[model samples]
Target: MTGPDRTPPPGDPARDGDAGAAGRFADFGPPRRVDGGLKARSTRGAIGVSWWSRRFLEVLESFALGTRLTRGRSYARKGQVLRLDVTPGRVEATVQGSRAEPYRVGIELPVFPAALWERVERDLAAQAFFSARLLAGDLPAELEEVFADAGAPLFPSGVAELTQRCSCPDFAVPCKHLAATFYLLAEAFDADPFQLLHWRGRGRAELLDRLRALRAGATDPAGATDPAGTPEPSGPDTGAPDAAFAGPTPDVEPVPAAGAARVLAGLPAIPLDEAVDRFWLPPVPLPDRPPTLATGPELLLRQLGAPAPAIGGPGLLERLRRAYRSFGRS
Candidate 1:
């Protein structure tokens, strides 16, 4: 069983105690390293590469863990962490410390309830851009805002939101060993941002499936809901025939059925040989000029935003705009 929350308040020197002192001392010495350890890819400077991972590390730093975090960073660099596993609501790891036996470490964050996730998934599915980016394995920076708007912050906002534990004899909430694990966790998140979602109680497959279902439902409301409970619409064939013609068409005149049939029967039947020369040509004369545009040619380019860097840089849009203007003038 886990012990009571002995985590001292932020900036409390008592929290560090003897463990804090040892952490500082360990900066000068090295802990027992492990073979085939999961070392951080970033050897120098910052640990996390992606923005999401950096945001996690930033949250950890804000906890005021002081020298212990520094020692953990050192431990991470030395590859002292033996193994790490991230699951829904928890991160478990084994770290090689000064002792012969490895220290067990765990960090827990509250998982969003199913109802909250439903809301989050709905919001995400509502936007095609967000769904497309996620499917392409790219986590947009704006996703954090999405979660925040849903009342479920994607990253832990404060230290209190995290429950940290280490089997090491450190009274400090996160001994150097735990700190090292945290750093590595950030790196892991950098590699696959879906790991962060997994830690928050939603696996990538499950989330993606739900997103797809929600999007499908949005497009077809008559379909049945998926297992995830997203509403899906039935086929268009189920709708009434009149529903297809529900919209108004003020300019169109409805042809009488008898008149239409007579018109079709009255058409002249020409021999294939006689019509061969004009088979591909229009029966009527073409317009004297092309149709005029209601908007400028550059309007499309403006709506599409900027082209990719490989296609054109910042000035490309301006040059294209000028070229489009010349087309109209000519």
Candidate 2:
């Protein structure tokens, strides 16, 4: 929704350039407009587009490079303004320019197939704004015919004659105003690719719905003729019968009433040696050894490899005292 092609002829006055009249594009009903058009949110579109896109804004500022924007020129830096209008088969984007000629450009958008939307999002606009994404990159591969139909190159150079000209006298270089408008448009795309889509008059939700319709139509080719034909699929019979009336079966057999069960006490006992050998044994205490500072409290202090006082438990301090006491005595 940026502007017309470089060689864009003046649009037909009899028509509103395919997007309809100015009033149609500016229709801001309840819940859609906010702060008087500073912000307009579509009720259906998730517009999940990150509330902010750094790269999109960067591209916008990219257009601002070498312009008065770098020098802080106020009027020259004013950005582009955009809006959208949607219909079943068409989307309209109103692209305003800071420079002359067609002060505004109206772009008509046809129902884009689902297959191309992602490519449009990723490689084109980086998915910043749906409408902006539509116009961001060179025309998508799927729509090569459209560009050819319009007699425009897929990629218009910054200085390409195919690029639409401005009424403003500023020549070769896009007038500062045009740059500002483009810069702002890029920012709008950065903010939300939906904006571009919106300008094109096609929001994310609408695009998805159209795609879904197309999918349904494709899947129901036979039904397409009937339109309302509800074809009952001749699939394998997978339906189950009502479960409440299933047949009953014979009961399980019961064991004899007086059957005996073995008791633990009645079992044969093991011999003492066998029992003793098989029983779990506590870990055996190691032979006592003299205390070594390395082992700390775990060290077994002794006269010479004897168990330390109760394994350094009760009277632990007394045991240490005695160890030192023997040092001087003998």
Model 2, CA-based lDDT: 0.34
For model 1, the local distance difference test gives 0.73
Q: Encode model 2's per-residue lDDT on 29-127: one tens digit a residue.
A: 111111222232322322223322333233333332343233112222321334434343333333333222223322232444445443333222212
Per model, state how many residue pairs clash: 7, 21
Best by the TM-score measure: 1
**Candidate 1, backbone clash total:** 7
lDDT of each: 0.73, 0.34
- As a TM-score, model 2 comes out at 0.30
- Error (Å) of candidate 2 at residue 102 is 10
Q: Tens digit of lDDT per residue, candidate 1, span 1-330? A: 234334445455543343444332232234675778888788777789888888788677755555677778888988899999999999999999776788899999998999989877876776676789899988877677667766788888776788888876666767788889999999888889999999999999999999998776554434356899986544555555442245323332332222123224445778889999999875444323211214456755653556778978658988998999999899
| Clash total of candidate 2 | 21
